[model samples]
Target: MNIPNTYGHLPLAAEAAGAGHPVLTWAAVGVIVTAVGVCLVVLHRRRDTRSKRLTPGYDAATGALVVLDRLSAMTAIAGVTTELGELAGFISLLRVAEARSPEIPFGVIVATLDDYAASVFTANYATRLAADPSLLDSYLALARVQGVKLESARTAITTVQRRIEKLTGK
Candidate 1:
């Protein structure tokens, strides 16, 4: 059955609009996300590689070596006749370096340094008796003992430095 239309035909306009194709937009977003992720990964790996090259306790090791070298020089200049105050100063420096040394890498050297300090401690105290001609010979013998200890510590430090260099590829 045909019925008369109650409403007149009205023209409605529709406009088409879009930023771009959906696939291209999504693809661009994915590419940007992937690039950002890759950059972050590269940055992280670089930091790790740099840290590996640096090596842990490297500064401490070098610092201890410097202190020991200084002490060795002072001992060489002063010999067995080192003044009490100067000997005390060297002992203090040694103890400080030994305290800061890493337990794993420098333990043996630290022990050797401790022994060196012990001998120096005795020598420092025994210097008072050096005025006695009879005790002078004994003091010289003690000094010889300290020289041996010092050499051992130096050897140990050199070994550790070589190991650290090998590890860090430096």
Candidate 2:
């Protein structure tokens, strides 16, 4: 009986076919699977560590204070818009912190931030009303309301910061 060498030109292919390199192929697959599994585990650990660090703590409190300070300094439409963008980012951080640790009293502060945003909206509306001189009193009233809301939010953030400082002993 004569066997034809179908892979006459490819020496490696002929040798692999005769040798039936099933073990080598399985070993390569096993190595690839192990590499992928290791990568997934490492990625999972990194994500867990990052999330743990982001949990509401001293850093978050300090960040809130900074955001609040910047927010308070903004008066013009452009400045206010920028500050509000920062505020929204800060709120997202707080929300993440809240999710990580439900024990923390972030709900109330989050609510305060919402109220602050609403007051800013009110102020924006009042500013638009400035075009109508007849609405001067209404605009002034809204401005005053916004000022009060700012103070309230500032107070809330400061209180949280103080508590965190005391807790951390820093």
Candidate 3:
């Protein structure tokens, strides 16, 4: 006599009766497919939103251009001052940068330059600012010369960034 075997333990009819295995398996597969579909939809939407935000033709582009323009303007101001006078002028420009472009990470550079300028000024004119008001004017004139060079340094940073973007097609 032949007997049906369900994995050598029971008949197929007995196993099928014990649980609706086929229906449960199909339900699980359906759920998995639905979950995968949902995930794909969400991922696609996120990618689309990100693309819109990062596109070079959008608001990011405008912000970058504005920053570049401001840097260029500062550079032009720096060109007319003498080396010593540049220092004071650069200090002023760095103040502007700090106010307008706080995200540029230029605070350290500006602070270093300011500290050096102050040290030089104090060393040279510590006794003058207290005597003659005209002495303060003279000190400012000298500081302005150094300020211009600091402005040039800032401009160099902007130029370097532009070059990198060009090379990378960014």
Candidate 4:
């Protein structure tokens, strides 16, 4: 004699006619499926907010300031080659800073870098160095001579850095 299993995958009609209530089994399956759906919805919402969460405290904030300090220093270089070198390092660090600290609006810095690369250098981060690397020296010297124009960039970077630090209490 085969003993009927209420929780088995076998459908009710497939089992002995009087074994159990098929309706009850179907209702239980419906409840399980609904619970799973609710859980998935909750997790999806949480995943978005999770990345924005920054590590709280002074250390991480201080580290972020260091990157800002370097970016500020990079603005002082009028030399194309030196500036490009600084840009490369700064861009790499900026990506890290953006990921590590949500408080910093890194996209703004990227825009500024993009503008400088396009206008002052007449080339982007990738192509700038490739074009007559020898010209970098002259271009930088010219920019340095006209350094007054870079002051605004220095101010903007510092201001953003301070704002982010203030939020971090660093």
Each model's TM-score? Answer: 0.49, 0.57, 0.31, 0.37
**Who wins the lDDT comparison?**
2
Local distance difference test scores for all models: 0.60, 0.68, 0.50, 0.54
- Candidate 4: residue pairs that collide: 78-140, 79-140, 80-140
Per residue, candidate 4 scores C-alpha lDDT tens digits across 1-170 of 99888887765574657647779889999999999999988886665443334333222334434544554464433354454555556656665666666556765555555455443433353366566697678766756643443444445556665675555444
Q: Candidate 2: lDDT of 84? A: 78
Task: Identify the leading candidate in terms of TM-score.
Answer: 2
Global CA lDDT computed for model 3: 0.50
By TM-score rank, best first, the candidates go 2, 1, 4, 3
Give the candidate order by descending lDDT: 2, 1, 4, 3
Which of the predicted structures, 2 or 4, would earn the higher TM-score when compared with the native? 2
In candidate 4, how many Å is residue 37 off?
A: 40
In the range 1-170, model 3's lDDT, one tens digit per residue, is: 98876567645784867864688878999999999999999987866654443333223223433443343333222333143364455456555554554444345545645543443444425556777777877767756654564455455445534543443345
Better of 3 and 4 by TM-score: 4
Q: In each prediction, how many residue pairs overlap at the backbone (N, C-alpha, C within less than 3 A)?
A: 0, 0, 17, 3
Cand. 1 TM to true fold: 0.49
